[model samples]
Target: MKVLKFLSVLVVFAIIGFSYWIYSSLNAPHAHSKTNQYIQIPQGSSTGQILVKLAAEGILSSPLPLKVYLKITGSGNEMQAGEYLFDSPITPLEVLGELNNGRLRTVKLTIPEGFTRFDIAKRIAKQFPQNPPEGENAVLNLMEDISLIKDIAPEAKNLEGYMYPNTYDFQRTVTTRAILEKMVGEFKKIWKPEYADRALQLKMTPHKIITIASLIETESRLDEERAIVASVIYNRLSKGMPLGIDQTAVYIAKMENRWDGIIHKSDLESNSPYNTRKIVGLPPGPISSISESSIKAALYPATTNYIYYVLNVEKNDKSHRFYSTAAEFERGKAAYQAWLKKERR
Candidate 1:
């Protein structure tokens, strides 16, 4: 009787100890060096393989206890595969939940309203570099593949104004091609049917409207004044006068890969068709990315007789003063010149 009682008590204590071990091991949090980065789990990996891999990666201090716990619970069979970003001090149970849900790690890529393809290339290169370290020029070459937007703007030389400006979330392992496709896809989505109809009424192609929109985007940061700026552009074009937009000279400098952050006299004198100072009407193509508001302003310019605009020094908000006559324009130009001189000092 005594031996039987001792044996029963020992068995009970052993079970209790085993239960505690399982609970503690499954619930205790563990962190690793790769907590900040993405860990890719290739497709068709077995649960056991995943545990072992996690153990190797320090995400699991030891997989034995979790394996036993899963076996006891008949779990771990529903684990899915994908790129995962595990948080620091995450418990094994939490990691398992993440795997079961297949929650992917995403990174945000934001394209500002007026970023050029070159600027985008630099951002992409910095954020999502290729395994072999792709250069900015290599990324720029990808934008040159205009086949993506051939249906929308068949005459487009490259994807300058078609990449919609917005914040996009992509998987950490997303390719540059995928990012470019998404941006262009977004642009296509926002190019409303009404815009096309309006373009027809204006006797302008979608490409031309986007080109004008790009100019407006670079010329004015104020959405309210973009239409007025667009009117100045249209007014100049109607009178067969040069656009004289300094941003076009800057764009020319960028195209030539000699942009020194300042528009020089040589840039203004450049004979490139993109130089608005030298060529009449719109540039050969867009000089920068376009925004929806700019596109709208381009399609529906405010009715005005304005032909010239200079920076409004009084407003101090980067707004421009519009003028209908050369005399009025010259006075505004003088104020802008004085402001520029003061700024330089």
Candidate 2:
């Protein structure tokens, strides 16, 4: 009888213990199941508020289990506030892990070669709102206030040509100054000491070389023809002839926001110092963003006495035919004009 009674008591104790284990396991809070869901913890929310919000979002099965687990794991105080995307069926533990790790999506901004600072600023404004004011004029004003490129070119009114074009990864909250600094730093890295010496050897300052390079960049898109174009500019300077580049007139028109894609006769006759057709020397400032190859070409032009070049209409390979005199250039220009008319027709 005594043995049977002892066996019954042991069986009851075992049953009680098993029941308690099952209850604890079922009530334990866990991450939500893997499904597409957003878990947001607003800024300035307290730990308790965050836990409550998580529970209400169905990410936590039970707030008590989550609270206890957090306290036990010492992760209750490590939650960060941000917008988080949770994969479906994620557990509370997984959410906690993500929060602790501070994971956020990154945005990419690509600045192509020969992009002006105005273009770059527009790109930044689209990607990062924390950036400075919008539009080319507003961005130019902000750049002047920052003095980013003033030391390099004290005469420059804006950092238009200095903003090297490249791909950049930034957070949504990144500032304009930070983005500009990265681009300028990249430019500096590419601008070697030897290049500076070469500029001096050519009787030009780094600033002047950059300014001329910008003009060459705007004139030609063919990398192989940059040196030839550079020679044209140099030849014109040596002969005291006006460069007569129409892009300069376009730039002047853009400054006044009066550009209409058509260069008016009066625009060529404008008294602006930037009017290369009216001026006998290089423009007072850069006309556009310059590539490294353009800069190199400006520093070391090809050994050619050819003073003029026109688009090669027959080839259409982005190559230009050079001529030492006006007659040959006129022939090339006539061919180009015929081709343009045919295309338009």
Question: Which digits, one per residue and each the tens of the lDDT, describe model 1 over residues 194-265?
Answer: 998899999999999999999999999999999999999999999999999889888888888999999899
lDDT for model 1 comes to: 0.90
TM-score of each: 0.92, 0.81
List residue ranges in candidate 1 displaced over 4 A.
Answer: 1-12, 30-38, 131-133
Worst 10 residues of 2 by lDDT: 25-34
Q: How close is candidate 2 to the true structure, as a TM-score?
A: 0.81
**Whole-model alpha-carbon lDDT for candidate 2:** 0.77
Every model's Cα RMSD, please? 2.4, 4.9
Give per-residue lDDT, candidate 2, residue 329: 87
List clash counts for every candidate, in order.
0, 16
Q: What are the Cα lDDT values of the candidates?
A: 0.90, 0.77
**The best candidate in terms of lDDT:** 1
